[model samples]
Target: MRARLELFASIRRDARIEGLSIRGLAKRYQVGRDTVRQALSDPVPPARKTPVRSSPRLDPFKPAIDAMLVEDTTAPRKQRHTARRILARLIEEHDALELSYSTVRDYVRVRRAQIDVEAGRRVEVFVPQEHAPGAEAEVDFGEVWIVLDGVKTKCHMFIFRLSHSGKAIHRVYPTQAQEAFLEGHIEAFNEIGGVPVKHIRYDNLTSAVRTVVFGQGRNRVENDRWVLFRSFYGFDSFYCQPGIAGAHEKGGVEGEVGWFRRNRLTPMPVAKSLEELNDRIRYREAEDDQRRFDGRIRTIGHDFAAERPFLAPLPAEEFDPGLVLNPRVDRSSMITVRMVKYSVPARFIGRRVRVSLRASELVVFDGRAVAARHQRIVAKGGQSVQLDHYLEVLKTKPGALPGSTALARARASGSFTSAHEAFWAASRRVNGDAEGTRELIDVLLLHRSMDAADIQAGITAALRVGAVSADVVAVEARRHATTSAAEGGPRSDRHRGAHAQAKVQRVVSLTQRRLMDPAAVIAGLPSDSRPLPSVRAYDELLAKRAEHPAKTASKENIS
Candidate 1:
């Protein structure tokens, strides 16, 4: 094409500029006179035209093929007639049409694509919506595969996007359960500082929708708890149609999930923990605030700031986003919550307790008293046992203390510091292993009332004095705790016994030391021996030199 255009251009230029005859230009360019005459008439190269051929047999059946292709758009995909079937129909049903299968196949291939293009152009189209600030929002959940802490893990990301500003809040969760769904809404609302006034659009997520009535326009049964949540926030909901077809209703957040994942979470985020991942997400969101979306004149942060005042004010109190469960504590003192088991007090075993499960923590309540609280474990079948909950059981089964989950957790949390370990080892050397472990459990029980550091420090103090008894550890812990309280500030309640006298004596001793000068105290110390005086030989030499300056200068000059 390039060579042909160049030849044509050169022929035209020579003919027009040099005023050469067609025959002359043909001879110069080594081409025929007709080619040169054509180039001279048209400055641009002529496009090659496809030769038209008469296919007398297939031409008559072209209308039937076009109609079949057009109707296939509304027909079931599998039921649509194939090219071979269409050919058979053309010969058998329409006797007048006479064409071979090969000829029909070649013609139908090009014609079918044309029909599809026409059908697509005639398909349903959406009108662009103009949303008001703080009046509309969209909520959706998207799946993201992230490498969390070196492990390739799949997680659900909840995306909440304000339609007007294109501002979005995204959070990752291990599961798209009802609890996480509700919690995501709570957090997103708090972050946005208000709720959308008109309607927050959502898909037919099972967390929010109990049932969807087919053929009913936006008429669906919503979840009870979800209804309450929506009522509390004072926002109406517009549920999109179910499945892929309904995705466009909440398109803002749907696109946001992909946009955010590609821009911020791409290249795979590696973090030590989920909390660390969330912290990174927070920083990414802050960075995103400065960026403007395509076709938008203002940045998201700027638009959100202007829209914030128009949003509905928050309710007086936050909604409780915890899902309530009543799981019976097993003989092992563990209650299952979301497939993960957490240990409560031993006394709760064989009984049902109320488990309030939030996204991050699970609180177990025995009637009015809180039995246990554990950081919610995301992994299934994982156990989170508090040693304090099993102390009573450990007291009876000292042999089990060596491999108990409670003990491991205590060590990991530094609640059972090395001081406790040292005390236990010394106790074992003196009182034997089982007895020592039992004694250690007794000291661990003290953590329920006193601070772990105070108890550990006391254990250290007791061990320094070569005492291994739990009683000695208790006394040391109490003594230091009391001293810490007294030294912090003035005593709230004055003691009137020997203990009070000792505290008063210590205070007086500290005051007297502060009042005494260091120099006087050093002078009061007894000397081992008296030092000898040194001679003033250097001073006498200086006096003689000062008296004979002129004589010494003359003597030095003669030498």
Candidate 2:
């Protein structure tokens, strides 16, 4: 009976046999049914024996097939056909006539075991751990829903955890913009009261990974701006590959991310505003610091307190998350920043203005004083502030001009209209010439000062006359000069005769000088020389000589 167990084992091991029935085996051995049945049913034990000959079908290409199978198991099943295809290619191309499809399949199965063993041994080699307080931290972002302005809005959750102490900080933001990301870091650092010396590990979010280079050990990171931000804040970043498999490295923050959303934001929390919602999240986060973990003696706050000493001291100046953009004011005295137009004083036209843009508000300054302020509007290409905003100041001191260049630009841009031109023209009339034109322009600018009516009238008068010339305007003014004598004004009739006699004497003197020296007379020489006798004076002297004719006759007789 014991020998029968060996016989049954031999039969089972034979390649030609499959299952050996008890009845069939009994008939073959010429034994009683019970005896044969017992022998057939008995489990076969292995005897120490020499190894059988290995299959020749699988022997030759075993190593190559095993390598293929090992690599295929990690790949998709559709790709496993590559193994069968390669086997077929070997037969066709290399005259491998003995290798059939079934033989190749069995060989591949056998080789797979050996390949798996090799692959299992070749895993990532991890270094032994040496944990230090505040040496490392993990960071990640999650999403949460909270009531904002009476409406529920989804927001991003930023979570960070100290690897050694298990201390954690969490914050929520309306957006995941880069500014918000950096700001969240700054706030987290402040809450922890220090910075971590070891690298901060995070999943490959766009803020960290600029591009992923396939097969390379490292990918290109964000621009220098982010690098400088990290350097300035005294921390380093370690970005994991961008998938669930790579996220295990940052498990600390990953757990914290879900924990924050579930514990703080769930159950439809309500808030008056986004800021209020953030305030509530902040309060909950602070409260969370007091909680203890399983088997830990200290609370998260206590762990953080102990870890604070190991962290680097915070820098003096806080990080500025605002973007600095340079924009030039167009001819319209308006600058476009982030799609919104802000008007500076017209004087700033054509000059470049620097914009320190934040998420919620825009503040414009000229040197130091706030030149303009506006609520940030997200739309593109529209004025955020009106030109009329600074109109009063421009009117008060027209000489404090943005200059003719700015005014001309404003006019060209339709900011200054035909009405403004009319007012300017009237002012020119009141002033006369280019000088008057300039003064009239100053008056029209009084769009801030004198009544618009008065300015318009002045401009109309100035244009009607070609008082376009200041000199012509002066002459017109003299012709229109009024005298007071006709009314209750000064009486000039009494002095008229004296004025007439003085005028005649001046004419007589001028005529005598002209006859004496015509060229010098034209030159208007001074009357220092003796005056010539008048024609009337010569006639009088001749008459007197004739009266003395009798005496002359007597003198001639004596001669």
Candidate 3:
């Protein structure tokens, strides 16, 4: 480059000083006449252009490949042919043995871009953007799997990220339903403390967009509920073009979802429930607030601290982030929601009940009061039941209690503890199977009004005195419940009572209990409504019979 520049400079300087002709300059510089003319005409040479290399062998098949690529415009994306497939077709169909896969691939790459640009379809380009504070945000959903209660379950992760600050919040839900979609926005808005001042960007998600007016234009027919939600929150929605072509529109959240899933949620989290898993994701979001994005001076938290004041103030009234459904409770005391069965109280059977279904739970309402609340079951055909919901049905059909789905779930959940089992066993030994189970069912009924710990304590109290009666257990349970109420209902010593026998093993005398607690021993439990039981009255009758025996013998002799 330097040598060429010096030659051009010397030729130009000499030509001007000596007034040399092109021939003289060419002779003096020992170069061609054209080169001397080129140096004289311009100080810098134009870039060299590569000559077009002809491929006569493959040239005939170029039209075929172009035709296939044109055909690909209308083909389903995943089913479209690759370069290798094109080359294989050329070899098989047209007998073009000269073409290699590399030749076809290189040509295909350049042609694909050219074709896209020519059609004004997927012309890939992005102008660097400067985002205004609180002006824009991005929302996206990514698939994530979590071990929910030991079952490997697939879940949807909704991410809302501020475009300027890069601050993001994520939540996991069983489905990407409209309720979850709207609920995610509400949660993110509340967490971020306000809504974006301008518009939030989104892909053409079905939850928001009912139809995309397919063209270069950004026209969309949105969901009615979504439109109302936007009106209520006072924010605008920006719909990106659909598919991979539009992924860049919401690139902030798109990249965030992938980055977070890899960095934080990589080792697929294990949780007992959807709520527990979401709690984990929520904490991770807070930690991300302190993160500094690449090439930025301010941390995400710092940028957001400045950006927050610019955001629009939240609405005074909150939006209801649940979908209302009126599902009729089946004869099984269960309602089918999204094809999943959830047991309501037996009283609601054969009636349509209002259910407010949220992302994580469903609350069944009878009138206005909640009849039953259960974690939303995600899996189709899955059933979730509360034992308390079916206790009434079990009363008349005591035999059904042993085989009922509610009982199985109760036992699995550790709600129906071993204490209940021990009491049931003792009762069966004292009475017969049918009668004993009926008594056990009565004891189970105490769980509705009494605390589980109090009920367990009552069961333990009855078993200690060899009182294998539901009546005795009820009396004892109420006593424990009243005592707990008097002592401010502290449950520092509370447990599942799985080891009901453990309490019986370490029996404390009444004197010892009085010594342990300095509080008045006379104030054991608030007075019972039932009369105190007395076997002493029966003993007194026996003494009277013994005294009257001689008198009764004298009366018989007189008769």
Candidate 4:
């Protein structure tokens, strides 16, 4: 075809250049006159050739290759033998066969329609029986590797599939905790538009099964809270046996598990945090549902749109993803939850406080406002949560004091007052023979149930007499024992006696003070001064002063 087209084109170009007639050129080129005329009139013409196809003799073994390709879809394309290899094998195996390598290649090329070159081979499309609207769903957990905050972590992938539409809802979480597992179901149900009426099949995850008893009967053991949550949500759980073979029983989710991992998580997604990773996974899963699977029929999302209404409506009350526990307040008036201490009101001391433990918060209430809120610490006993509960109690009752049990047990251990400075000052004075001061302190402490006025009065009496010794103050207390023991009590016999003794001591001390500072006494003289006085003359002056003031003055004048 190429030669014929080129020959005609060359002759027409020569005719136009040389002014040769079309018939003359046709003869010169040793061709038909009509062909020359057509060539001269048209710049180009289409070529024609006989179609050559593969001979059956060349690819007698094509049926065998096609069967192998169909059976092993997972095999690599290169691993599928070359056509030359197939031809040689045929010749060696059967001497009666005759086929060249090129012919075999041609046969393989012609039959390429049967080979799925892109996938190396064809896979049988999975077809599930049409299911009733609210019948069942398949549930499973897959694993995904992601980088959260620059650290690589393995996240659990939860997938739920509706039996009718093949609609899949999935999420990724940092942990496979029962809370996450159950919460995953709730979110999946919401995504699918409603909860399925029938059973949800699952593998033997510890979140669902506590133990996998053999033929005796599988235990559908789950966390108590999880069970309650499921009951509230209204669903039946079906657990598969704890082996690979059992996966066939719940093939829907099993297939979805792999399908989501491949289609949704393709290109190895990178996320800044586990939360971000989960968000990405959710978005892609939704997109996957909208995409056509096996390139046929309605998409998963489209089918789900129709099947959604048949599912049960979400209950009026949403599931509470919180754990409740009763934790007792410690002597510190604080309760420890999740390694953190939250304070309650001081009155709640020695009482149990109800704690509401959520994923991110630990909340404690005092029948009113939140008494304490903390970032939940997820540790057990001995690891405490410190709450600032009854701290204000300390402010109001400053003397309630603080000490370990042993400190309290040893009362005389001198950890008596929360006011350490006041205690220490009293202790020092008592040690310094100021027993009155110590007695005053003891009396003041006794006023723990008394008015401040009474205590202040007791302190005043002790200070007034300069008998501030703890013992002297004690003596005064005993003297006034007949009184109401309040600040203004009647004097008892003991009080009068102590008072008399105190007065006598004051007189003696005053007389003794004459020998020390007579000037003080002299300065306390009367306004009248008739005689010039010296220390020796003081006695005679005193004698003169004792007489009646007028008589003494007159007798002095007469003498």
Q: Count the backbone clashes (under 3 Å) in each candidate.
A: 0, 9, 0, 28
Model 3 lDDT per residue over 382-469, tens place: 9998988877777778788888889899999999999999888777766667777888988988887778887898888767655667
Reference-based TM-score of each model: 0.69, 0.47, 0.70, 0.42
- TM-score, predicted candidate 2 vs. hidden true structure: 0.47
lDDT of 1 at 187: 83
Candidate 1 per-residue lDDT, tens place, 421-535, comes to 8878777766778888888888988888877767987787666555566777777776666666555524324332324423421111222222233222222334324434467
lDDT of 3: 0.83
What are the C-alpha RMSDs, in order, of all predicted structures? 21.0, 25.9, 10.1, 21.5
Ranking by TM-score: 3, 1, 2, 4
Q: Residues 1-559, candidate 2, lDDT per residue (tens digit)?
A: 4775766565444313756566666666666666654444555543548887667765776666666676766887566645477687667765677877877776666566667677774534445454599889887778888775577677777777888777777766666666567777887888887889887887766765677676876565566668888889878887776666576667667777777677777797787655676677677867977888757788888887888899988999898765677789887677887667777767777788767665445677677676667655545775565444445455555553435445655665565668556534444444434444455444444554333443444333334432333233332222222122223233433233333232111112333233332333322435445565568767888888888998989999999
lDDT of each: 0.81, 0.63, 0.83, 0.62
Considering TM-score, which of the candidate structures 1 and 3 is the better prediction for this target?
3
Q: Itemize residue pairs with steric clashes in candidate 3.
A: none
Model 2 worst lDDT run, 10 consecutive residues: 477-486
**Which candidate gets the maximum lDDT versus the true structure?**
3
